[model samples]
Target chain A: MEALFAIAIGTLTSCAVYLLLRARTYPVLLGLTLLSYAVNLFLFASGRLVMASAPLTDQGLERFPDPIPQALVLTAIVIGFGMTALMVVLALRAIHATGGDHVDGGER
Target chain B: MNHLPIVPILLPLIAGSVLLLSTKWSPNARHAFSLAAVVGQLAAASMLFVTVREGPVLVYALGGWAPPFGIVLVVDRLAAALLVLAGIVACASLLYAVARDTETSAQRFLALFQFQLLGIQGAFLTGDLFNLFVFFEVLLIASYALLLHGLTADRVKAALHVVVLNLIGSALFLLGVALIYGVAGTLNFADLARAIPALTSADAPLARTGALLLLVVFALKSALLPLGFWLPRAYGAAAAAVAALFAVLTKVGVYAVLRVYPLAFGPQAGELANVAEAWLLPLALATLAFGALGVLAARSLRIAAGWVVVYSVGSLLVAVALFTEGGYAAAIYYLVHSTLASAALFLVVDLVAGDRTSAGDRLDTADAMPHGALLGSFFFITAAAVAGLPPLSGFVGKVLILDASSGHPAAALIWSSLLGAALVVIVALSRAGSAVFWRTLSPSGGARAPRPSLAALAAPAAILGCIAALVAWGGSATAFAQAVGRDLAKPAVYVDAVLGGGHAQPDDRRRLR
Candidate 1:
């Protein structure tokens, strides 16, 4: 399970980095979204993986997953969503204004 | 629990919500309301500053939950001083926007402005790492909209860079936070401070990596070299008032560095002591040199001002890199001085550019602008201050920084780089000044530009007056900065106040939940 999680994060981050280095706004936006996903997953796993042990369980439960990282991941997800929406709109506007999708607003 | 610590954050949050809902109101009414809110913030910040001075650190826990578990807001002398600085800049910039009639041109300008304040002040006051990330996003989102407030081709392009870069920065911020939380088992700053020093040797490397990653995020925000290439264009493309307010934005990153590294990884931290010290000074000096070259290479006054902002950050951080009380004190004094100086420069650029028909702030000889003498005087004084000329606050700031670095091993390199940057800046600024004010071509655009209203002049003039006051009251300001430095140098008081000395009932948190 740990290996799978680490591999998933690594793949997402590598892909994100590649896309981020592209010379266009849309790709960069996608890259940012992917990076956020990787980050969110990373934050979620920071508290050590646990199964059948959710927070807010019955009072007599002997063990539970650390709840703080769950809360943090949730917050990260919300903020990431908002940021992605904002970037989508901003990229569209940039493309419209410059009549090109190049990040620098000029032909390469 | 004096509620004043939260006022700076809450006042702006309330004001922004109110302004957001008042879209149907007249511009005058919105402006008046926003101005009142900013004035209230200034008052609260001043009171908070006074209360924290020579007093215990003020801690406010949210929902009565104790630290190492719940979120906390801690205000020491450093945070209080930054709060006041943020307030002063916000007030002046808002006043400038109101007087210049720029606020009415955009939808929800007043609302966004107030939200930006909330983010800045909240970042300053929050004692939780996660909370700081949230506030950073708040400010960045608001700034994104504000940057594109008066939509232009240049602005859109600049916004794309600024937004994308910051988005990447946010991702890194999360990664760093997660790493730190995993290794340290805590997110609250004070708690983390206590948890870090006892890390096992196996965990030390991971925690150090996380700390350094966090530093990278901050450096990116602060516009340290190689990461700051986007700053000039983005800042130049922003509206005058927005740019003025942003003068302190980079300082937020510097504040985080000063707050986090010194406290968590200070002299006492085993293996990670002075984690950032080795890299900070050299990078800072490089950034200063790069900013100087940028200033000389910029094609316009606004872009030059942006580079000056970058230059000031580098200079301020050089002092901070020393990690001594004297170093922190110098950095604090210079931080206040440079924030105001750059802000005043931006406002003055707007005025000068407005007074011309076609010149439009480009650093070129053009038709003589109206009130050239008056605007020229403002530009000259501000330029002198930015270039660290004598008789202004910038000179004093540089001297203090130099004096603080006198005992460092790299004192020679620091002195040469700083002094060289100042000399280059002086030349670049003088050239810009002469191009705009001194070497004027014949009037080209037909109608003469009108003189700016006294109200418009008042804002920038008032900011300049603040700088002059820094000079006038140099003694007291230095003393205050030293006090802040002392407080920062010893984080025990700040830690205790937040984690142990607070009124929160941690045992009841579970039941409440």
Candidate 2:
């Protein structure tokens, strides 16, 4: 499961990097979204992949996943959502104001 | 004492929400509320710094929960100093905004400014990695709005570029956080410190990959080398006050790198220090060279302001690449001086613009209040500060960094090249000085001369001049730098405050679980 997750994250990261390299604004936003998912999962997997176990423990259980990473990842997901929304709105506004969505041709 | 650490962040955050609700009210009321919040924040930051100076570092856990399971706010000497600096900058910029005749509505401007202040203070104070990300987003969102406040064609173009590039950076930052979490199973700075060493000892590949991801994310935000292309454009196009506030933003990124890299992933961690020293040194040199060249090539005062941003990024990376106590100290000192100087330079540009407009009207008057002479003095003094002239704060910081690089041959080379480039910068700035302040229109009689409004804009420049003078005097400022250095070199003091012990032993971890 960890191996699969790692591979999936690597794929997403590469895709995100490629899209981010594009000159246009929309693809870059999409790229950031994909990257955030990969990051969220990567953070979740850092606790060493406990199978079918939540971070919160039941009675007499010897171990569970680490609660700390779960809590951190939850915070990150919310923050990531906020950042993505802000970027989308800003990009749309930029297009309306500047009449161009390309990052390269803007005034220096 | 525990609760005091969180008040600086909480006050502006609550004020921001209230301001959003009160948008329907008169601009005066909104401005008054925002000003009150900023002043309150400044007082809170000052109180927090004094309290931390008197005691051990202050730690405040959210919801009264312990660390490793809850978010924390840590206030060490370094964080405290930075918090105070952010407060001062915010206050000064707020003052400047109130004085400017720009088209931005006061209510909207103050609202965004206060939110940005909240975000900046939060980033400095938060002890959890995820919390850092949250505050970073807050800061960025506020910055985007503030940058677009004036909504010019040039500003819109610049803001678009800034948004797109920063989105890429944010994505990478998230990826890095996720990767580190997957490997270490904790995101609290203190927990990660304990968990990373054990993880790296067990599996080298995981630790190496995670460290590299984080380095990239931080480099982008801090505007290191190739990733810094977006900064000059975005900062150059924004209003003077807005640009002044942003002068401290990238430093937050640098602060994160310093805080996390040395404490959590140090030299012992799987080639981490080596990777930083190796690639970052070359990047630092390249950044310095590029910034110097950019400054020389710039045609307008606004464009030169852009190059100053590049110069600051270069100097920051120099400190980071040195990776010594002295190096970090110099970096911290440079961070403070550069932020102040860059903002001052931007403010000076606004003054120059005002002078230029008045000069354009005064075509025929030969002795019409030598606006050019006043500007000439301002530009020369500012250029001297930026180029690290003796007796200036910039020089003190640069000398410290150079001394820190004494033993490292590569670092010394990089430092020397930077000195040479600074000379070139001095020359370029002098040429700009002549063109901007000395060069005049043809002597053909055309129109009546208009009086210059030097009094209106002199306040910001005078404030910067006094700060530069204080830094140059050096008794108290030098002592402060030494104190800050001691605190940074020994982050154990910081970790203990947040975690309540030096390290979390295996036994303690078992007990907690």
Candidate 3:
């Protein structure tokens, strides 16, 4: 389970980096979204992955998952969503103004 | 509990909301409310500065919840001083925007500006790591809107880079926080400090990586050498007043470095003591040299001003990397001086550029500006101050840094680089000044340029006056900076005030479950 989780995050990050390094704005935006997904997953898994366990429990359970990472991930998701929307609008604006989609607003 | 610490954050938040809700209001009314908010913030920041100066660190718990379980706002001398600095910059920059009609030209400009302030002040005051990230997002988002406020092709391109880069920065910040929390089981800064020193061997490596990752995030924000290439172009493209407010933005990164590393990873952190010291100085020096060269190579006055800001950050971090009492003091003093001078420089650049119809801030000969004498003098004084000339606060700041570094092992290297950068900056500014002001073609067609209104001149003049005050009150200012330095050296006072022993419950997990 640990290896799978780590490998998933590693793959996502690598792909994100690749897309991010592209010259165009759309690729960069997609890369940012992927990167945010990896980050959210990493944050959630930081709590020491537990299966089918409630974050907080009143019953006398021997083990329960930590809750803060969940909260952190939730916040990251919301912020990430807002930022992605902003980037989309900004990319559209750049394309409209500069007549190109390259990050520098000039076609290579 | 004294509520002064939270006022700086709340004032802007309220003002921004008001401005956002009242879209039909007159520009005059919006400007009045926004300026009033900033002025109130200045007053509150001044009172908070007084309260924390010789007094204790003020900790304000949100909703009466204790630390380690809930978020807290901690204001020491450093945060209060920065609060005061931010307020002053916001006031001047917003005033300049009003005078230039930049704010009225864009939708929701006033609200976005206030939100930017809210984020800055909140970042300064928050005691939780996650809370800091939240404020960073707040500020970055507001800045994005503000950057594109007067939308142009140049602005859109610049905003794209700034936004994408910062989004990546945000991801890194989150990853670092997660690693730290996973290892230490806490996000509250004081609790992390308490927990880090006791981390087991296996956990130490994870914690160390987390700390270093945080350093990357901050270095990027502060525009340190390798991570800062986006700065000059971005700042150069921004509206002058937005760029000026952004002069404080880099310092936020510097402030984070100052606040976090010392408290959480100081000498007490066993293996992680002074974790950032190794990479800080060399990169800082390189950044300084890079900035100086960038200034020399810049073709436009605005870009040169941007490089000047980068140069100042380099020097400020060099002081911080020294990790001594006097070093922190010098860094604080330099922080104040550079922020004001750079912000003022941006405004002055705007004014100079506006006065020239054909030249448009390019460092080449053109028809002479109309307000040549007045604007020329402003540029000269600002350039002199930025380049560390005598009889100015920049010189005092440079001297303090030099004196503070005298005891370090790399004193020779530090001295040479600092002096070399100063000399290079002087040569560059002089060349820029001559090209813009001195070597000018006569006005074509004999059409004299119209004079700028007093309102436009007043903002930069007010900020320059503040720099002059820093020099005139050098003794007292330096004394205050040293006191702030001393306060930071001892982290126990900060931790105690935030956690206060009896208030923090160690077993928050069990209590929650």
Best by DockQ: 3
At residue B144, give the lDDT of candidate 3. 92
Kept native contacts, fraction for each prediction: 0.90, 0.72, 0.82
Please give the distance, in angstroms, between residue B496's alpha carbon in candidate 1 and its true position after superposition: 1.5
Q: Give model 3's TM-score versus the native structure.
A: 0.98
Better of 2 and 3 by DockQ: 3
The parts of candidate 2 lying over 4 Å away from their true place are A3-7, A10-18, A48-56, A105-108, B268-275, B358-370, B442-459, B462-466, B501-513
DockQ of 3: 0.72
Clashes of each: 0, 6, 0
DockQ of each: 0.67, 0.55, 0.72
TM-score on alpha carbons, each prediction: 0.97, 0.90, 0.98
Off by over 4 Å in 1: A55-57, B103-107, B501-513
1 or 3: which has the higher lDDT? 3
lDDT of each: 0.89, 0.74, 0.90
Docking class of 3: medium
Instruction: Compose the digit string of candidate 2's lDDT tens values, residues B372-405.
Output: 6676677677778888887788888788778878
- For DockQ, candidate 1 versus 3, the one ahead is 3
Q: Against the correct fold, how does model 2 do in TM-score?
A: 0.90
Q: What is the TM-score of each candidate's chain B when compared with the real chain B?
A: 0.97, 0.91, 0.97
Least accurate 10 contiguous residues by lDDT in model 1 chain B: B504-513
The RMSD of every model to the true structure, in order and in angstroms, is: 2.4, 3.6, 1.5
